[model samples]
Target: MESNQEVQISTNAIISFTDSYTQNKQRKEKELLEFESKSARAIISFTDSYAQNKQRKQNEQQESESTLSLAQVTSRLESLSNQIQYNNGCKLVIQIPKLLQSLIALVTFRIGTHLKQEIDLQRIEVRRQSRWCLSSIQVYGDEQIQSELVRQGYGRVMSITLSKAGGIDEEQDEEIYNGLRSISRFLRGLHAGRNNDYQPSFQPLPLLARRSIEQLEEEGANEEIEAQMNNRYNGLIKVWANDAKDMILNCFIYRRRR
Candidate 1:
């Protein structure tokens, strides 16, 4: 009987030990799973943070570079402004020859490899820019500078540019009108209040004005194209005609004053 009781006790102890070992193994597995999940989460969070930081740094660097570029541009503009204000545009005076050459090329539209219409548009822009440049020179320059331009044959060159209409294609009607407008502006800039004797011996502004008006009248009366007739380019031509009239009157008044 004692042997049988000892056998039963050994079997119960073995079963309890096995149950306890199984519970411990399950708990260790749960802990290991939780640790692995936390590690994965930590890696994900670190990667996301690193990416955000890298992008932020790149954006900041770009912003900083943009700011530096803007600052440099501002500094240069301020320096140029100071130079222009203090020295009466001495720098501009020194660059007159180069400026004239560039303006001449632009006004003539002789340096492009674009479509015909696009080139014509560019020519219009360049002509307008040239007029503005000349106007600026007239406004900023004194009599001495004006005389220097005259001595440099600026008057002769401008007159010829106007007379030739900058070599614009005649088929480009709009460009023709624009050329006339710009030519009137060029003439005004060249000799608004200047002495007649000081002006280049080119065709007189009054005579040129008459010729331009007559040409416009002829075109309006004689053009057979339906598009040309409906365009009323002659009406628009009056804008340049009026400008020429003003130039003529100014020339007469200036001559009388002299």
Candidate 2:
């Protein structure tokens, strides 16, 4: 009777042990599945985020490329509009050496042809090249190039030369060229001002008549003319220089608002 009872108890213990082992195995399997599911979800989310970032970057790159293309287009248009084309097929497109050569040829031709003398092309070429080299060179390396040039009367000489090089409409070409020379001369003063009158302000060349200033000075220095010296050219020079076609623009932002 005791052996029978012992056997039954042993069976019950074995059954209980088997059931616990099975439950533990099932829990481990469920945990493994949960871990795999979480890993998969993480991978998918990362892929989506990476794809979105890549697309955003591509869009930005495209927009930047478009902006760059527009800038290039605008630059080309401005260059085309400003480029000067001579009847002799020489185009002035901001190239210093080529423009210098054209200027020399034109100047030499004008001088030689007008006097019915032969042109010294070699001499002209050499002088033009040497002048080109000298243009950027510093008398003492100060960026205020105007004082050095002005002291030497370089602006006056250049103005005279531009006036003499006659091919285009003389009045128009001379006006444009002279204005360019003046602006160039003024630019040299920008880095380190030499003319005490020219402060760091952005006021362009004052076009008040030289005679008007002299007269105003002589007549006990009129209060109005004294004030005019500060900003008078702002009102006058553009009207004197702009063409009739371009004059239409002055009706808006250009004309004094006051």
Candidate 3:
């Protein structure tokens, strides 16, 4: 009887150990599966987020590109012109050489010899707006700003433009007049500024203007054109010079009084 009881106790102990081992194995397997599932979910979430971000960037790029239409450019130009009417705006734009070059390029841009009538008209309008902006800069800007513009080939461009002949319509005439006046005004400010106004690298406006006049004459500008150059253009230049001088003198006196 004692032997049987001992055997029964041993059997019970072995069964309990087996049951505990099986439960531990099952728990480990369940934990491994949960870990693998979580890793897969994390990778999938990352991929989706990456795809969404890429799509958003592409949409933004398309939207930005679409806004660069001709109408948008013209509207922006007009807005810029209006802003430049203020002193701060004029100063801000003048500091950026690239922006200045872009503005000048717009003035000189030509699509082709044969553009559609509508396209040509749009081009003309854009050019006109650009010219207006430049003119405003020359008018509102100081001598240093004017000198910078001239240094960037504004004077040279105007010289070439004014010297063009054979198509003098009302609009062309107006353009020429404005171009000439713009040069004259800038030259006036530059002269009044003297050594105090210009950078060391800049050439004098008077020298450039004289050379331009000579070039126009050599290009076969008629006597009528010559007279317009001599009287109307040069005469305005003199008037502007005097105006600039008086302005300087007044500023000087005012500072002295202060």
Candidate 4:
């Protein structure tokens, strides 16, 4: 997705200063409104056939596959629970990642698209580890990421208008080279704002720049480069999802006193 290089913009702090300061708290409430990814298909698919066959051998067990959602049940848990609770009542909580990703994908897709034409976002995703965690809405998407940087950049211009509704502007940045300029500028601007200043321990790297780094690591690259690359890679991944988790917890803390 091309960046919205020329979208008119502004840094109006009208997003409720109270809420902005309470970014953590707002983050929590926002979090509660969302749930985690269920399970992954790659994992689920592998377990499905294995699970059914295993169940057949344990004919003494009486668990029905229909009872659980694909995203909520795991092969091991299902087996153990069925075995332990044979002819008895039991509670099983099997979590999967695929379902969660699907949910995040759906929500993100909707949000990004709904807000798209305005800034021209193509897609959205749940944060990096939302599938692993139970509640997080850190949105992710290549196009949306680009869109965010682009929109945030163009939105700052006084000549441009921030009130523009969903309508694609003719101008868009071509690639990461053009896009990061806006993102870097936007982030720097965010640092200027007092509210978003509580910088986290981790820093993020754009997805566009990760593949080569990862590829090099797999090839057993040099220590200095690998360490740096891994640190940056993991940092970005954490910032996307784990940072949100911390933010949500802190939000809860601040909320109690308020």
Maximum-TM-score candidate: 3
Tens-digit lDDT track of model 1 for 98-144: 44443333343332323366544544554444444444454455455
Per residue, candidate 2 scores C-alpha lDDT tens digits across 1-258 of 443343234333323332343454465467557656765778867666556655664554345334324233223322222222111111112222333222222222212222111223322332233233223322212323223333433433333333333332433343334333332333333322343432323322222122222322343323322232343334333332232112222223221332
lDDT of all predictions: 0.43, 0.33, 0.51, 0.25
Tell me, what's the RMSD of every candidate?
35.1, 37.9, 31.1, 23.0
Which runs in model 2 stand beyond 4 Å of their true positions? 1-118, 138-140, 143-145, 166-258
TM-score preference between candidates 1 and 4, better one: 1
Instruction: List, residue by residue over 1-258, the lDDT tens digit for candidate 3.
Output: 443343234333323332333354455467557656765778867666556655664554334324444455566567667766742367666664456666666664342322356655555655666677777776677657665666667755555555541122555556556655665555444443434423322334444444433443454433333345444444553453344334323333433342
Candidate 4 root-mean-square deviation in Å: 23.0
Model 4, 146-235: lDDT tens digits are 233233222122111111112232222112112222223333322222133222222233332233223223433223222323333334
lDDT score for candidate 3 against the true structure: 0.51
Q: After superposition, how far is residue 80 of candidate 4 from its true place, in Å?
A: 54
Listed per model in order, the count of residue pairs whose N, CA or C atoms clash below 3 Å is: 0, 0, 0, 17
Pairs of residues at least 3 apart in sequence or in different chains that clash in candidate 3: none
Where does the lowest 10-residue lDDT sum fall in candidate 3?
10-19
Question: Once model 2 is optimally superposed onto the true structure by TM-score, how far is the C-alpha of residue 22 displaced, in angstroms?
Answer: 99
Candidate 1 colliding pairs: none
TM-score of each: 0.36, 0.25, 0.50, 0.16
